[model samples]
Target: MNRPTLLVSALWLALAATAHAETAADASADANAEANELERIQVTATRSERAIGDVPNTVDVIDRERMETLLVRDLKDLFRYEPGISVGSSFGRFGLGDIRVRGLGGNRVRIQTDGIPVSDAFSIGSFSNANRNFVDLDTLKRVEVVRGPTSSLYGSDALGGVVSFITKDPSDYLEEGKDAYFGFKIGYDSSWDGLFGGATAAFGGERWSGLVAVSHRQGQETENQGEVGGTGSARTQPNPQDLDGRSVLAKLVLETSENQRFKLTVEGNEDDTDTDMLTSRGRQALTGAINDSVIARDHQSRARVSFGHEMDAIDAGFADRLDWQVYRQDSQTTQYTREIRSGLAPPTLRDMREREFDFDQRAYGLQANFGKDFSTGSAQHALSYGLDVSRTETRQKRDGLRTFLVTGATTPVMSPDVFPVRDFPISKTTTAALYVQDEISFADGAFRLIPAVRVDRYELKPQADNIFTEDNPGVALSDISETSVSPKLGAVWHFNEDWSLFGGYSRGFRSPPYNDVNIGFTNAAFGYTAIANPDLKPETSDGLEAGLRFSSAAAYASLSAYYNRYDDFIESMRFIGFNDDGLMVYQSQNIAEAKIYGLEWKAGLELGALSDKWNGWSLRGAAAWSRGEGRGPEEVEVSPGVVEERQVTRNLDTVDPLTATLGIAYDRENWGAELAGRFVGRKDRVSDSSLYQQAGYGVLDLYAHWAFAPGATVNMGVFNLADRKYSEAGDVPLVNGTSTLLDRYTSPGRNFAVSLSVNW
Candidate 1:
């Protein structure tokens, strides 16, 4: 075993041994304290407020305190130490893409902020990409991540899991005796040469309260460990870029009575980027021309307005508590590219191309949830129900112009692509869902049975205007209407005060996306055409998970195993056959079956509970192992002029290899420090042999925090302490052959980040 792996194993053994050595009396006291703490840490990703330990699933919560201590600036940083979870990013161009849970990512994972879903991610070709990085970390109070399928409670996109970001409220900053509060924070990161600052103010009166928070950030391109510099594909260094971002969050709350409250929130986020694509220089495979300059300017923005109501202790015959919200959100992304090419067909001729791509979405939604507690003949029950309704309009456009510098003439027609084309028609999708869940308790809550179900209706309408028809003549569009029913059953048995056994079976499904159903494009120069497929079926999964957990004030541990089976998986842009025009045809289809299974274990220990001499010392460790495979269709040649398709089974490349993390920390009243290490196994279970296989690597990180004065604190961290040159599997693309540009995808070297916060 490697050094990091050995260290993690030793830490887990030490924690288990220490807990075993504790006296019975001490164990009982610690268990009680742990129970109380768990009860206070509530998670809302389940569609209901429940203690983390009470939920029969793998759930992780990152509160503001943890975010501050870790100095998390992006999604990649947020999930650095988390096993079975990772963020995908494109060579610093699109920045962070989306969060992947287990082996699923992209639109399969549901991402929301304050109960409103974020915009979908879309990409076409190499010049256009729209990502789902709309939320600002500085405005969030807490983040909840639910692993595995959870569609029974969250609806369509929860085929993988759910990520919920809850924003801060005025009450959070207002103390009992304080009527008004103000806070400020600043931070810097060496990885991107980034600087950020934010300010927050809250005012509270007898029945009225208000809050406003604003933040701004500026940064350069993210650094990598690449040594080679200059231009062309041979260079490994990061391309030059500038990034600017801003965010604003404002809220107003009114308490009508002790049992009722109302709130209004307005939030906006904007980001701009400019990149010099030095890598694109000296590349001209299509035109055989030397590229002089290639530049890209992109902007992404999102705005949301919501109104919500909360009521408690309502004696109305049906229930006792209620929560509802109505919201509207708009998101847009624009990418523009300007390129100049010299040494064309004529030695003295030069060409210039300007391309623009836009993707926009506007959504209106309403959600209502109710909770009731009642007793049956021999069991107590906690009943929860909710309804969700949402309508979203999605639109996309691509426009470009190619100009001959000598002639001063421009044309919208490029050989491979034409200007002013819509990849898909303007479409509107509406979804309505209703879910109900009940928890039955017996033997004084020692044993509980929970069952839940959700019914969803989805409808899509496409409006193919001139922009769409003009590009793809004689194309037929199809409307989609479908309904899905998902159900789940879970049980939790508290065998003892300090130990529990929990397990559950859940069903998840994802509706066919609009773009996939109505996609249309033609590349005559490439001798290929991509058409829409309206007969696609939704993807479904059956997941089973079980785990044993032990918790105490002094130590905690858990071991979990899960198996998931998926059917009718969607594969986009798969080659089908040749059309009547002798052009290659591609279409999206549901043609895959997959099975994934994994084991996860975590443990933590506090030395203060063992001896006074070891006070303020703690150890924590976690590890995960997973394997997956899928059966899909692959084209094969039967004879010289005949081709056929066959079902093939291969390892799923999305699943990461064995990974583990270990951390040791020392804490005092005013200061604390932690040293953490991460270990990853080699990635070799891939279907494509030509893909780059990353080797096993180990990295260490150090973090520290100090509160030198009242209401003032400083946090700092150094990541990749060994300056190792490594690459995450997700960041590396499949290369056709032995490529010399592999170093370009390596992760950053040693870097530091620091932040300061003050309140008055």
Candidate 2:
């Protein structure tokens, strides 16, 4: 049978069995009752404690239970079922990728941990990847995603949205009435072809608390069954990878007095990956009739330290709570590559090359906030104000060497001169911001309003190295400073107990990072030179959103739509002008205006409410659709003077295809199982310069959890149950300047994973 037919058949069989299977009715009823006692979920995405529904914005929360149930091993695994989001593997699974939201991605999104930014956004030679995957999932308590502009809370890098990961504390580990706890878990994954394990210990006391966690993982190459480049005749080989990592977390909390507390947190991670480059994308040295080998070793490390204090004992009448924090984060990535090529005729090594690239970044910041709550006649008000200051520094270096093996002798291929492949000098950026937000409720909490504003000042300075400056004597270093204000206004009306309406308008901005402002390179082989522009302006966004939510004991649903406009879009622009090297030059410039709009919806239903027979079953689903276009400068020579015109509507590359997820879950007192289907629609809309398009595909996953014994449990997941081979939207990009897809980078197909965990 065909793939689709088999999928339908399997689904039918599973549904039939679930519907007719004999189960303990009384047991199922009790399970339904237990599930109905849902706890209120609070989120810190808004920089304040608020229930999920109270926030006048689109927010999604994934708790520890869901993470385990879904067998989440990494960022990609966690976001598989999330709508309007796509994680791109531009480089490879190890590094060089980004996460997209709505129709924007890359540096537009801000990723944080415990309200502090994590990794630095830096890419050169397309080697930079989103540094989000280094964190161990076993240490995370929950993750929250706030969709859309959030500059009113976070200063910059909030143009698309914010993804915040909160780690576990002593309280999360200690059971009720318990002062100390110890837990450990070990698991394996078929896709990764590896084993993983972690352990945690926590102690809680009246005045002091402490927790420590350690995790380690090692795995082989990820599996992929799809054809090379989505074609039958594969010209390039596929590369296999070796991966391993370790993570450590430590936190301490001290209560100095009643209503006053202080916390110190330290987290660190180290990951190393080895890849066979001959079969990797864009690294194949021999197309046919020859044997070649290329190996790449990538090492990444991250560490962060934070100290914070929270106090509510202030006697000042205008303030009820105050909090302040200081943090420092450091991230580094280094890659070493070696390649050897041999001719089929003699099967002897003929050429060899070695290359290395290093990128490092550090950030230090301080933040403080104050909150006040009061009530007037018939009205309630809550106000929060905060200030943030941070300084960031980055450095990049690259070196390469090539040799030819002839007659059992090695000969150098280049002149004896110092050359840097990626020669970006040290760059620094300092940012300062102050923001305030106020929430007001009227008509006995029936109607609410939120108004917020933030002002930010940014300074960018470039420190050129002697090696770079000496090579190009005419090159000049410059500094830039910019300031902007972001504002947000929102309103919500609770018409009844189970239904509410909300709408909001917000503004966001993204200041150009050091790389964008001072990036410099000259490639004589490519006949091009690219230089950064100090005059480049920051990217700004204006978004308007409206939605309605319905909530009850048996069902919950939400529908939202958003429209966003972006100005001063940053993009690479080429000018056919002669430089000192007499080569065409490319410059980073702000040359476009764009618009994006999308719709999102989520719903869940408890079948038990309909009848006693269906009490243990529930249905949950989510869907998202987005579209965007951009306008760029187009100049035309007229009869007299030149005329500038905007080009026709051009599709944006960041927009993901229409996607949806549907699932059915059955729960018992000690065990539960879920079956889910994720569908991705065809994406024929290609950007102006894009040469590839992604076909539609669907995947069905089965997950089950069982506590067979006291303090012990097992979890199982069957991903891509149909074994349908496919590729992620942005994973398989078309060959640059051509319509043919590349010969690598396809999503894995048909994998099974099982994990065992014991807690005490």
Candidate 3:
């Protein structure tokens, strides 16, 4: 069947099931009691505690229980069933890159852990890449995803959406009348021959509590379903690799009074990987050297220390509740590559090249939030206000050397770049923001109106030292200072107890990134030079969304439609033209406008409501469809010396195709199982005509959990049950022509994962 027909059929089937259940029995009142109880509170949507159904926008929460049941090993697994959101990958070297919401990725989406921003992703050329995969899933208590623009509350870097990760506290583990708790878990995955384990301990006293958690993991290369195995670009199999990672999380809490508390937390994570790059083992036409062997070692680490305070029900003149935190974080990524090549100047001589790239960022941040509840006549109000201030310093450097194997002579020069160079200067970025939001209710709680606004100031300062100046001679550095304002308004009308309609208008903006504003590099061998552009403008988005929701004891369903328009979108590394020196000039510029529209729907039904024979059975499904187009500047030559830049509209390649997921589950008191299917449509809407369009495919997955003992349980999952070969659209690169390496991008086939956990 076609995409539209399949989607319609699924929706019709769900509605039919719900109607049948409603007519079959009178037990609908108690059908989904457990589900209602499990999903109660969320904080990311409004920056305050509120029920998911009460929020005006689309919000999804994945708690610890869900993560465990799904056997989430990484970001990809975490979002496997979530529509309209995906994790981008960097082939097999850098693993996962960033989370894409709607049609935007990279720095457009904001990610935070415990209210602190995570490090940004940076990439230069082919060998150096620093991604935003710093969080360890083992330490998280829950993850919240808010779709659409939320800059009014989060300030910059929220043009698309926000992902908030909340970690576990000591109180979560301490039971009533118990002062201590301990837990441990171990897991294995066949896709990568991976093994992982973790342990957690918590202690509580009269007024003090403490907790410590540690986790470690080791794995081999992730396997693909490729059949060809050989050296050079023809090799479709995965390279040989070894991966190791570990993390530590510790927290201490002090309760001073009935309504006051303080907390101290420390977190650290480290990851290392070694790979034998067999794909690069062929003749290189660019340098005219035969590659014999290539190897790479990558290291990534992050550390953080934070202190926070919280107080409630003070009823002070300024606020009724106050919370604040101060934190310092450091993150770094270092990569080293070694290659041995022959067929150089003389066939008898060989050369060995070694390269190292380092990127680091250190940040200090302070945030304070206050909440107040009051009433004026018939209107009720809940006010939330906050301030955020942060300063970050970023640095990057690349060094390399080539040595002759026989003569042992060393040279500090590579083909495209020289040794000991800096891509952009040592820069510091500072931001300060203040925001206010009010939730007002009228008509006896039937109608709610939310209005919010935020003002932000951003500054970037570049320190050009000897290294940067020597690399790019006669280049002038520049500074950037800008201010932005974001606003949002939303309303919800609950005409009845089980039905509601919600709509919202939100504005978002993102300041120019430091690297994009001041990127300076020279590649004499490639006949191109990248120069800095200080006058680049910030990117902005305006979104409008409306939805209808229905909730009942037996079933729940929601459908939302959204349209977002973006202006002044920044396009990095765009080639303008050849300069006076006959070299191509590349620069980052704001020369694009785009609009994206989509529809998202989710539904669930409890089969037990129909009759006792169908007890312990349920059905759930979700789907999303989006289309986008962008208008960008295109150069046209009218005459010999006359050129014009005209706007040309084309389909956006970043937008994913229609996708849907459906699952049927059965549950008991101590054990449960689920069978799910995921469907993806063909990708034919792309800006580049030469790009390969992937065909539609569907895959099946099975998951189960059983509690063998009181404090022990085992979770298992089997993915791609049919062993079908497929690849995600985003994971596939933009190959300009028919390529033989397409099989390398295929995902793993028929993988199984099993994990065991025990608590005491």
Better by lDDT, candidate 3 or 1? 3
Which sections of candidate 1 miss by over 4 Å?
1-15, 21-40, 347-349, 523-527, 637-643
Pick by lDDT: 1 or 2, better one: 1
User: Candidate 1 on 393-493: residue-level lDDT in tens?
Assistant: 99999999999998988899766677899999999999999999998899999898999999999999999999898887777888999899999999989
What local distance difference test score does each model get? 0.86, 0.76, 0.88
Candidate 2 local lDDT, residue 309: 97
Whole-structure CA lDDT of model 1: 0.86
lDDT string for model 2 (488-553, tens) is: 998888898756888899999999766666656665666766676889899999999998776555
TM-score for candidate 3: 0.96
Query: Please, what are the lDDT tens digits per residue for candidate 3 over residues 608-685?
Result: 887789888888888988889999988779899998988889898888899889999998889999999998988888
Clash counts per candidate, in order, are 0, 3, 0
> Least accurate stretch of 10 residues (summed lDDT) in model 1?
31-40
Evaluate model 3: give its lDDT: 0.88
Worst lDDT window (10 residues) for model 2? 18-27
Candidate 1: residue 614 lDDT (0-100): 69
**How many clashing residue pairs, candidate 2?**
3
Itemize residue pairs with steric clashes in candidate 3.
Answer: none
